[model samples]
Target chain A: MSRLNEAEIRRIAELAVKQLEGQATAANVEKVVHEAVQRMSGEGAATAARHERMKNVPPHNQAKGQRIILTAFGANSIGILAGLTSELAALKCDIVDLSQKIMQDFFTIMILVDAGNSDVAYEQIRERMARVGESFNLKVIVQHEDIFKTMHRV
Target chain B: MRIELPEILETIRMTEVEHFDIRTVTMGINLKDCISDSLPRLKNNIYEKLMRTAAEHVATAEKVEAQYGISIANKRISVTPVALVGDGYYAEDFVEIAEVLDKAADNLGVDYLGGFSALVQKGFSKGDLSLIRAIPEALTSTRHVCASVNVATTKAGINMDAVYLMGKIIKQTAEKSADNDGIGCAKLVVFANAPEDNPFIAGAFHGVSEPDVVVNVGISGPGVILRAVKEARNADFPTLADHIRRMAFKITRAGEFVGRKVAELQNIPYGIVDISLAPTPMPGDSIADILKAMGLQDVGAPGTTAALALLNDAVKRGGLMASSHVGGMSGAFIPVSEDQGMISAARAGHITLEKMEAMTSVCSVGIDMVAVPGDTSAESIAGLIADECAIGVSNSKTTAVRVIPVPGKTVGEEADYGGLLGIAPIMPLSKIDNSHFIHRGGRIPAPVKGINN
Candidate 1:
């Protein structure tokens, strides 16, 4: 069986939603979309393809451009992002993406960084970030992107 | 697909604020082929094989930890039960073998090497007897070698003779390491129906059925569960259980990922992920704290056992869904000394040894890391093991005892065994003597549960 591409999956999902519009409840729409995706993906073929792709990516290349997800939560303070991003810059880590917000007087920030070219080790980067966060009374944590992907994604 | 930012942040929060981390990635190296009738050759063979198999164990685990930013708390090795491998060896010969294990573990730079163990659930073989006798000296002499003896199983019944012998061994081990606060006893455990693939010490051992070498992972995160329960404080029972189940699912998935990665890197088969909420001496990382979060005033409060039963069941239900292969004592551990909340509860007289036994009936392992008075009789200790074994055998669960009789320490006094073993307030034991019962050197017949086959 051929593997389903991203576009094919999206098309199937959209079609399933449209076909179930009036007759199906929200959960039924979800079930229809899920079944459509499952049918289109040809059972285990998509997973096999993913494994094949993962094998071709060399470890050196994988390590050269590592992804890190950093989160800081605690007291809401001004210039917190400036302080954090500047520390990443000093460590030679590039911020690929970022989001920050304050809820109920608690500040929360999430930053995705490419630390491939960083001069320091990942542990050192985490330590520095934690130290900077502590100065602002925040709890900082740095974790690799794979953890989130493996945990949240199938 | 891009992962949700909230999920990513929650994972980060768990590890950063809560103590979510991979507790152990133990390499199980089978030493069956290293057996020899000559003691010296046996030791040499075992050492060479362990060095070759586990040389990269610690380094590989550390490398994976660095790559994933997950803390692998301990790197350890569990070899084939030494009693089986040292078939005809005597007590002294077993001690020599233990020294070799200690040397290999030191060379590999791992913290602990388990499986200086004997499985005598039914009856003692020559090797089992020799190993049991050698346990006290072996544990006292070796720096990182841990020992366990299985004295009961559902099918085989409880070996009262082995239980009584282990009681004496425990006393001797405590006295042998008296200067170190009976720390040797901390490295030993007696089990009923012990899991072969358990990655946690002091009870990890490679079973005969296991492959030549395997990598088993033990993932722990009591603090993370505590935080989740705290957040769901006002929720109903179903919501609370669902929250714990989801958290356990995530934790086990993380463990499975790490275990597979480490196994692949080391060129060994991935064993099982022990999804136990193993507590540490750290304050927030206490399983008892999770119980308190479930609305219990303190850990040993009246509703604590029921609360623990719910937590344990939820953890297993969630973890079983996440991992394809889940084994070991995969539930909540209520070790007294290892958990700060349990320690304080014992000191405050809110928890006692009897209550601990009751709690264990619903949890993973029983009567673990409990410290008793110096004068606690060996017979009484054996009686404690018998009771715990009865619980395990009747219910077809795994129960273990790692009680330490701290030499020269009385009730209300504390004995400190630093590092992960932690400290414990010596609890008083029953005054009633059980020497007659323990001295009745025979097996207790298997219960009705064991007759299923």
Candidate 2:
């Protein structure tokens, strides 16, 4: 793009100050004019340029969580509108398949994990699950894939 | 140690163990060939079949449980509807055969033997006729044998004659077993759409299509589900729904795991998982406890129906989301003798048979563990079973009755079956009788105009 010369920048600054004259007092207009010149000449707004450049970065840097299947009581308790996949993303857990049903209560969730950088422990996962149950008034349980399918009929 | 309160500690003990258990190991042996003209030969064949089936069943079931470190609450068997097998055999001969079965179960170390049943949904076969006729004597004569009659089922309307006969037979059966806590009646169940693969008794039957043998899992957890629901009640509706869904998923998963393992160890095909909230006669093991925790004084309180409906819906919803194959009566149970809260409610005059029947509309089975007065006619028992079956047929759902008539035990007297068949204090029934109509001996026609197709 063609750059504005010093003379043009000066005229632009003058016009900007003239338009703001009725809305501001003399000292305010002079302060505004001084700030306008810095922006127009690219002396400020470096972060805005950097943001625009980073907008074109690769997709790998913006990946999200995965989804899996959870099985439990009465009937399919998975919500139709959201589906488990979306909920898994919301909760940052990867889900796989519906596994088993137990004594008219308790659901088993099966998930695939990267476990790359999670700070949470397996016990913590169970505690968070207990909290989930308390919050939703449900009995949510998690099991590894082997244990789930081992007890399940094909 | 800061010890917990006594009652609470007792509740925990009951949840863990208190001699309440898998009451019987019933091996359902098919008796198709035990129909000889000579009563002696028929009896011998029946004994041989039951002995063969029960022995292997006990050994295999015990071995499987030991191998997997999982509990097989009851190691029982069910056979084809008895009437089908005893075709052309005299009713007297059938009684001899039933006696043989009792002996076989005793000899085989099995507690109870089920499948002395007849399926007369559409029309009674000649054998069905004889078996139904001999029910009272057959049950009364045996110590370990159990019998059930399917008089009505979906697609088949009620049979008034069978209904009436069942009532009379139940009375007779009660009279015969009077000294034994009317134990004969304890072994009977009137069913509609009975599953052929249920692992539980006194109504389980092995269907025709089943492999010569197969394994079914009956996992129970009134306590587990109640614990989950009680923990979640403080949350909002949506949150509570999610919590129930998650917990149900886990419990069912556990059952599914154990069921498959049992099936594999038995070397049989795995049957569908039945997520019925089977309650125990133990304190914390009651579904009514869960309801009370949900804020009810007793099971039949005003909001009880709503609570049951919510529980049924929530349970099914959660179970379906978790398992692919769901079958049998997959709802909560309310059997009086089988559940402590129910027994207490009946004893305290807080619950009645009518209310229990009403609740069956939302339960896994209808009118289970109900004990009536010994003097009551078989017609009334038939009427009770019929009414319960009618609800199931009309709704196209599974319903059943395991009504016990404790012979010498009065309305307030107790009948103890030891172990899972806990002590049962009788409940009062309406005096309105139906002997005449039930005795009419013809069929109650299938719903004519109700069919849309």
- Candidate topping DockQ: 1
| Per-residue alpha-carbon lDDT of candidate 1 for residues B1-453, written as tens digits (9 for 90 to 100) | 666778887777677678889999999989999988787889999999999999899999998887677889999999899999997889999999999999999999999999999999999999999999999999989999999999999999999999999999999999999998799998999999999999999999999899999999999999988887988978999999999998898999999999999999978899999988999999899998888888888977898889999999999998999999999889789999999999998999899888899998999889999999988889999999999999999999999999999999999899988888888989888979778788989999999889995
Residues B30-144, candidate 2: write the lDDT tens digits: 5665657666786777777666645566776565443323345766656667777777777886787677777877787665667888877777788888897788799878866
Query: Model 2: what is its DockQ?
Result: 0.04
lDDT (0-100) at residue B118 of candidate 2?
85
Q: Is the docking of candidate 2 incorrect, acceptable, medium or high quality?
A: incorrect
Candidate 2: residue B157 Cα off by (Å) = 1.0
Residue A9, model 1: lDDT of 70
Q: Give fnat of each prediction, in order.
A: 0.61, 0.10
TM-score, every prediction: 0.83, 0.68
| Candidate 1 residue runs with Cα over 4 Å from true position | A1-66, A70-96, A101-109, A113-142
